[model samples]
Target: MLTSIQNPLVQKFRRLQNAKERRETQLFLLEGTHLIQEACAVNYPLMTVCYTSKWEEHHPELRSIVLENCDRVELVSDEVIKSIATTVNPDGIVAIAPRLAQKKPPIPAKLTIVLSTIQDPGNLGTIIRTAAAAGADGLWVSQDSVDLDNPKVLRASAGQWFRLAMGVSDNLHELVTSYQQQGVQIVSTTSHTQTSYWDVNLTKPTLILLGNEGAGLSDDLAALADLQVKIPMETGVESLNVATAAALMLYEVRRQRS
Candidate 1:
């Protein structure tokens, strides 16, 4: 068993924790049996898996599956697993998987989610999970947003990240403009807007634009939107959390299309 944290393989896995290394190697660490299983189930390319003996004993079926599908499986000490894991208490398994390629599929007839400058990884991940659950066609994030591959983001997504088509764009305005050219309506959310979100015709091909946690959509992007709407709130409550707001908006689109 690999007992030392300095083992070459363990070092490689540890290096994957850094954003720059992840970008350079095109690899990231996925901890916990569920996340690793989700990746393997989707046939996402897995480079290596490290697990402790106790983990293998408790999850023999999963161990066999990992051994069968993965090219490399190392039996490591629990300490080694802990060293490589980002969580306070890991589930005794971690896998190294290649980063997902950014995809820009043809905009679907359904609603798309446009995220601008969303800095919180948990928020971004929860939004992604919500988007996938709501059957969003795709998701686009501005370049300034949190890294979709951030470990917290991955964990918050609850494996739904694998099921979604997502892309990052340096120019959100241009991206939204192109969608508009293709006859998709841009819907921006703001408190000052008089239009209620429910009033918008979401049955049409639409892109729902949500902005940063602190600042809402930039004025330029809001101005470019075909419609600006707001969710009606009780007095003294200004707004909802971005992810909650996204879920409400996306499901409303689904309700309309149904």
Candidate 2:
């Protein structure tokens, strides 16, 4: 049992709290039994783990995961485990998982989702989750989007980030424009658009551009869209909530393609 607060591994796990540390070490922390099971199920290369004794009794699957897959496991005191976990009740387990390298070469898929400056963690996470479910092959979030590793976002995503080969780009315009030039049809979601979303050919190489809650897509981003699509709404409602709109469009796209 690695019970001491002064232990070197404990310090190492604490370092994972920072984005710089996670990127530099290629490691991000996954707290709780659900996420731990997710990591093990995906065969994510987990470096280390720590769990409270009580969690072992309460969650047998987590115990099996810790014993079978964790490279190293320490019987940590609850206080020690809590120090590194992000949630209020962390289910008494934390895993250090290495970030997989993004694949090179363009992903050959007709469907993609481009997120621009999406600030809300829950909305961003939900969109990505929906995109994955919709069979989107590439999901690129602009530089300013919320970090996928943020614990709030992780909870919303339900561990989909580990399963999806999503990308992050520093230049939103260049990336979007480049895709537009590549015979790709860029679609923007908007409140007032000439074309209805139902008219879009989702089976083609397409990138759905989404923006921050307040701002919508930037003027430049909007201009780059081959066409903008808006969901139809009833009498009083002006538009769908961002996450709701995203789910409708993405699944509509899936229906169109499938």
Candidate 3:
């Protein structure tokens, strides 16, 4: 069993915790058995898997499946697993997988989500999960948004990230302009808008723009939108959480399409 935390492979796994390191190495850490299973289900290649004997015994079938697919598997001590994992409870296993490639799909689909400067990893991941569930064709995030590969994002996504087609846009203005030229309507969400979200015709090809949590959409982005919409709430309530707002907007599209 790999007991020493100083082991070369263990140290390498530890380095993956850093965003810059993950970017440079093109690898990220995935914790817990469920995530490993999800990766395997999607045929996501895992370079290595580190597990403890207790985990192996409890999940013999899963362990065998992981061993069959992974390039290498190591029997490590619980302490070693904890050292590389970001979670309080490592759940006795961790796997390393390549970063999802940023391949923009040709012909952006009818329904798309454009996220601008979403700071919270949980919010980002939740949006991804909701988008996938709502049948959004793809998700486009602005360059300034949270790193998609963050562990918290991955965990919060509940494995939906692997299924979603997502890419980061370096120039959101240019992207919106291109979409608009193609006859795709850009819909922006904000409280100041008089138009209720339900009134908009989401049946057509649409790109829904969501902004940062504290600050709403940037003025430039808001100005470029084909329509600005707001979800009507009670008198005292100010606004909804970004993720909650996204769910409402996306499901409206789904409802319209259905």
- With a 3 Å backbone cut-off (N, CA, C), the pairs that clash in candidate 3 are none
- Give lDDT per model, in order: 0.88, 0.79, 0.90
Query: TM-score of each candidate?
Result: 0.96, 0.89, 0.96
Model 2: per-residue Cα lDDT over 93-182, one tens digit each: 888877777552264457778888888889877886787777777688888888877666777778776677678889989988888788
What does the lDDT read for residue 250 in candidate 3?
97
Clashes of each: 0, 0, 0
User: Distance from true position, residue 60, model 2, in Å?
Assistant: 4.1
List model 1 lDDT by residue over 10-59, tens digit each: 99989988988998988888888878878878877777999999899999
| lDDT measured at residue 115 in model 2 versus the true structure, 0 to 100 | 83
Q: In model 2, what lDDT does residue 95 have?
A: 80
Residues 1-258, model 3: lDDT tens digits: 999999999999999999899989989999998888888898888999999999999999899899889999999998999999999988899999988675563345699898889999999999999999999888988889988989999999899888888889898898888888888899998788789999989999999998999998899988999999989999999989999999999999999989
- Estimate the overall C-alpha local distance difference test score of candidate 1: 0.88
Decreasing lDDT order of the candidates: 3, 1, 2
Q: What is the overall TM-score of model 1 with all chains considered together? A: 0.96
